[model samples]
Target: MFRNVEIALASLYVTTTGVLIAGIYYVHQILGVEQWGIIAFLSLIMTLVVGGILAKIAITPLREHFHHLERFSKETLHELNLPINTITANVQMLRKSHTDEKSLKRLERIEIAAEMLKERYNELDYMIKKQSEREKIEHFDLREVIEERLVFLRSLYPSVTWDVMIASYVVNCDRIGLGKVIDNLIENGVKYSPKNPIITITLQDNTVSIKDQGIGMDEITLMHIYDRYYQSDSTMAGYGIGLNLVKRYCDRYGIALHISSRINEGTCVKLEFKKKGIVDG
Candidate 1:
């Protein structure tokens, strides 16, 4: 589609230039050198007018395409919220009415899944609102967010050993975006680690560190870790955007991000939040 648009624009430009040149030639032939200056000025004005029109024509479809995509995203997110909300409400009702242990456990899993889905929905909603400069920034407990993400991730990776030492730290930022950053870091730790991986999470003094006993990256791989879609191990199953997302959120929120890794040892990621974004309880 983009290629076609480019070709069309290029063709229109060439055609317009040709017509301008031909018109100049015809005017120069019919009139004489005395009128050359006036004709040249007219041609320049005509070229500017034609170029503006052509530019508008070329941009119209692209503008419409982007608008269509934005509408689709908003509509899809709205539709998705309905079903997720339904599942959450039903699960809560079932939990209250059913007293059996097995049913309650199943309901708990469904609730967790629904919460995960809701988090994803919020992430998407954040991105959209962020583009429109409408994302909400509020004070939230950083430790609570981290613990919530750990709960969801632990459910998914039950075999992995988790060691968490977190202190109460409140931060003012886009909560969903920050939550996504935490989720990506922890998920990557779990994904890259060996079976029964030991993941350690520590939070203190407005800084958080996540260390994983996984097949770590070399110096070269570490350099490109934040490059979108650049994976250290292609054999590993991932799109390689996790670190990229982490880096982006940190940069946007004035958070300091650092990663250290060795080939055979493991990887450790640290994030230091900005002082202004932190609030003391």
Candidate 2:
């Protein structure tokens, strides 16, 4: 589609320039030097008007396509809320009534699944709001958010070992965005690791680090880690958008992000908050 648009645009430019050149030559020969300036001005104005119309016409379809996608995303997210809420509410009621170990375990799994769905919904909503520039920044406890995300992730990946040593540090930023960033880093560590992955997380002095014993990337892979949809290992089951989103959020919030890895050893990611928005508690 983009190639077609490029072709159309190229053709439009060539045709417009050819016409302008021919018009100028004719005016120069027939109208003499005195009137040439006025003719040239008129020709330039005509070219601009024609070019603007052609460009708008060529771009209208692409614009409408994105508009439809955005609208569809909003509507789908709105529809998802009802089912997620229903599942969560019903699970809560069941948990209150059931006391048997087997039944409670089943209920817990259901509750976890529902919570995961809710998290996904929140992630999608956050992305939409972020693209639209509607996300608001506010002060929130960094430790609290990381702990909350870890709780959910631990439930999902029970085999993975978590070593956390987080301090109470408050920072002003998009709370949901920050949560997404943490979730992505931790999840990546889990996803890329072996049978029993060990993830180490620590926070101190407004800086946080997440280190993982995973199949680490080489230097070339690390260089392209932030590229959207680029995956180092094709066997991995992910669309490769995690690190890209993390990079964007960090850059936007003035957070310093550093990632280092050694192949077969592991990967470590660090985020340092700017002093202006950080408050040690």
Candidate 3:
């Protein structure tokens, strides 16, 4: 709405100025006097006053509406987090207690549901953080971070087998942003793969590659993979924001990304980070 208003006002200003200039020149020619200068100044002043009034009128409701939405989103997210955290914590405690196999399986399912909600919440949290916070740069070991994420993912998808060959390498990056990139890549590999899938991750010479034996894509589907809300398989569970966000983070950090896939075979994604001048321990 605000963008529309800005464009409209800009067009109005351009059109109005052209007409006023033409009118002033013609009036000056007709009257042959200095009074036309005063007329032109008054006209400009009136136009500015009217434009300012219109802008204020158009913007007030839009401003209020956004404020309301922001407030609602914040409050609702807070409420959602409280229950999710409580359920997750309680479920973990239950896992340590004595329980039958059937009950344990049920609890495991509940935990998976909670974790899935947490992933959705994380996506929302990622977006909110992108808007409100500056990226934090820190030196860290990429191998350690990948290992940590893999631990979490393994619990989520126990049926999938992982082959990791990442070497320790220091990198300067935003931890949260990079974590999201790794999480989304691994999550996609796990989610898209068939039962008992094999996903391989290798890090070498500042390049990290994740390969999965899954239902691969055609060239047409792969072309639009980076597009937001563009999913090759609509029936799969996702908002299609994961790959788009991964691309966004990679671009922001000067990382090079590549993808290779063959239909019914698998998909391989690679990210190469920019090299730092020196490796610091």
Candidate 4:
């Protein structure tokens, strides 16, 4: 799509610029006053045509970008599918073989991670068709998920405050999507917040909230919170896919995803969970 636009714009620029210069020369030396007005109008039209050509040229890089991302998405899907199955099956095998306490515990975490990867692969497969029958849902421990992601988030945002409540929120959710949503929220809060500012994460009754006392959002950002590539602040590190995943999980599990923020103050993200309720709920 962008490639076509680029080509069209580039063609327009060449045609318009050529015409405008010729028209001005004709109006100044060859044409009289009456004809000059017509020539000038033609020149103006020529400029617009030239602008279109430039737009086409500018769209070349965009076309390449779109192609790269699309191809990457397809290639990665093929690569990730096999690994997901292998890991999930291996995890199940380990779980059965492990009878000791530590072995059982380690296998449990591996099983959870494997389960998440399976859902992620399924999401990739269902992305285009959006097959409702292949939906991935399960009861997830929010604390475990948060802890798993904390190691990564700490690396991403070292200065921001890190807080996680010592409780379990076994909410009915899609493990992969839920983990991605929460990870995105926490990372967003950490990235946008002022250094050393308090980032609070609290859980109660299956509701988990991540609040940050950092650069707050205004009406515009708040309105399009989950919009793709919406990085109004320029400082935050994401293309807005984070909150989008959050929204996805929210829709999948019938949970509430709320956001409130103010400039120079901070933002609060609330993830409402279904209390052991099924996905159909």
**Which predicted model would earn the best lDDT?**
2
- For candidate 3, lDDT tens digit of each residue in 1-281? 76876776676677667666765765577656578568778667766766676667667768777788777877888899999999999998998893899989999889889987987787677666677655567788898889988877888888888898998777887777788899889888878888899999999978899999899989999889999999988899999988998998887778889999998899999988778512221
Error of 1 at 229 (Å): 2.1
- Count of clashes, each model: 0, 0, 0, 7
Inter-residue clash pairs, candidate 3:
none
Candidate 4 backbone collisions, by pair: 6-56, 9-52, 9-53, 9-56, 10-53, 13-50, 13-53
Cand. 3 TM to true fold: 0.79
Regions of model 2 farther than 4 Å from truth: 1-11, 22-26, 34-41, 278-281
Better of 2 and 3 by TM-score: 2
Model 1: per-residue lDDT, tens digit, 1-281? 67767976996789679768966876787665458788888777777788788888888888888889899999999999999999999998998899999999899889878888987898888888888878678888899999888877887777999999999887988887788888889888888888899999999887899999898889899889889999978898889888888887788878889999987688999999877446322
TM-score of 2: 0.85
Task: Using lDDT, rank the candidates from best to worst.
Answer: 2, 1, 3, 4
Task: Choose the strongest candidate by TM-score.
Answer: 2
Candidate 1: misplaced stretches above 4 Å?
A: 1-4, 19-45, 96-98, 139-141, 168-172, 275-281
lDDT by residue (58-153, candidate 2, tens digit) is 797688878888999999999999999999899889988898999999998998899889999999999898888898778888999998898899
Residue pairs with backbone atoms closer than 3 Å in model 2 (clashes): none
Question: What's the lDDT for residue 127 in model 1?
Answer: 83
